[model samples]
Target: MDKNAPKIAIVGAGVVGLTVADILQKDLNKANITVIADKFKEDTTSSVAAGIFCPGSSFRGATLEIAHRWIEDSWYYWQDILKTPEASTAGIMELSSYVFSKEDYGVTRNSFIENLVPIYRSVQGEELKICGPDWKYGSYFTTVKIGCDRYLPWVEKRFIAKGGKIVNGKIDSFTDTSLRQYDLVFNCTGLGAKYLCNDSNIFPMRGQVIRVKAPWLKTAFFGDYDTYIIPGLDGVATLGGVRQYDTYNLKVCKHDAAAILDQCSQMLPDLKKVEIVAHKVGLRPHRVPVRVEPELIGGLKVVHCYGHGGNGVMSAPGTALNAVKIGYDFLKTNVKNKI
Candidate 1:
């Protein structure tokens, strides 16, 4: 490492933090980037997600335009990766999805991604029967899915190739970590932010998923009760889930597994015959504004990019791109910060 090079620290190794490292490394080729996190890859909350590209209405930012920009930018980021031979290795692929509602048509609509993805249209009358006969309203659209089981390692390799470092440890606080010694730090710690920043507004949105070997299922399906069937790069498909707010239980509840299977199988009956692979639970970092800004905490310049709730995996690249922009500006102006 050069004695006077730009030293940057990024907290959290989930998709969000790693994406920050990836983008920053590309943009600031000479900067020293270190990714510190207690958990990695499959152990991360991001791994528990189906890694769908569809952003719910709840996915937000400080402003409407900012939120819109993040989603749009993120789509293109993944699209670029999807075009490469590395797409399969990177766990990035395209898949169409159907969102159905038995009661309200509004549940089937996604304003955030209507125009962003390559395809978004109301489902035909017969298409509703594709999932089940009870579905009253539905929409079909083409989207992307990322398999973090493969993505994390793929991105880490590139980050390391660019001279980035990955460290293993739990970050107790921004001021408490070795990151405080760096010129700039990006706080992408997700739910850990609740304790790391003492933020009362940010809480856990507990979610569960059941992974099953269902190769025949190519399209993703979203039904009521947070139920979804999202296919991955391999033959494995993720079926789930429930968003229990403010819960911290990491243990896999049997009740959740039963409900997820019951609901998912109801939509796609063939799922009942698939081999069960795994059950995953994640505490999504939920925040109202989806924090993505700068703070000078005890003179330690930090740019936060967490609180994507369940959308972190889907939106990491864009939020990370934005966080790097802020972090770069901080690094340029702060000449005396020490590490």
Candidate 2:
């Protein structure tokens, strides 16, 4: 370790923060790095996510081009992992998904990932009836699914083994005295940025999902009204969901669980008999364009990398890469205390 290595602090333990930490550790070997967060494995919104690589049409970066780059970069990052023998242990795998829409064909088409995935085309013939007579429009795409349940801990172990420090703590604000020692800070606080930076554009997009024991179900499915069925490792499939924008409620809503069950079971009758595993609610940190820029705040150099909404799990690596790049550049700039 270099005695003059840069000291860095990461503000969240979720997918984004950890991803940033992992990448930075590789980019700046021997740089002192610490991950500070109030939550850990199974507690973060990332864990509740189905971890499918399918990004919604609304998911974007600072621009359409940037957004596309993030998705493409992420695809290849996971692809590299998928090719490794540790893929299953790392909770990364290839997955095929079918999305059906009863009313509009547009709902079935995903412009964001259609060209990126290996296979993405309209469902035809008996395929329409695969999900119990969808009878309208559909598209089948082969993508990847990440199960954060295994991923978070796996990456954490790697980080710690590489001498990265993990602090089970909360950061009240960017200017909080605890951050004074670090030469650079990466603020991947997700929704917490709404208060930390008082960013009005960032808000909670509440989402809920139910995990079930459906060993027989392998492929993923999506239907109208934000309905989705995603399978993960260990025969545990995720059924979801409800997206209530600006809603901050985190408690598990019985109504949302019931609705998710009903909707998912309707698409795959076998889900009706699947054993219930757990219900999860997460407030997605949503903003039109995710924040991945740097600033000098109160003489501290920081890179903001939050507001990924529901796409954080799939897009973490790409955005983290961008954040680390910005952090490297910011590290060279002489800091001048400013508001």
In model 1, how large is the Cα lDDT of residue 245? 91
Give the range of the ten consecutive residues with the poorest summed lDDT in model 1. Answer: 330-339
Candidate 2 clashing pairs, residues 3+ apart or interchain: none
Over 1-339, each residue of candidate 1 has an lDDT whose tens digit, in order, gives: 566777888889999999999998887788888999999988999888889998888888999889899999999999999999999999998999999999889999999999888889998678789987888999999999988999999999999988899899988876675665688888989988888999898999999899999888889999998989999877999999999999999999999999999999999999988999998999999997899998888778889998998888889988888888888788677455542
Q: Which pairs clash inside model 1?
A: 181-339
The numbered model that scores best in lDDT is 2
Q: Candidate 2's residue-wise lDDT over 36-145, tens digit each?
A: 99998888888888899988888888899999999898899899989999899999988999999889989899898988898999998888999886459989999999
Instruction: Assess each prediction's global lDDT (C-alpha) against the native.
Output: 0.89, 0.90
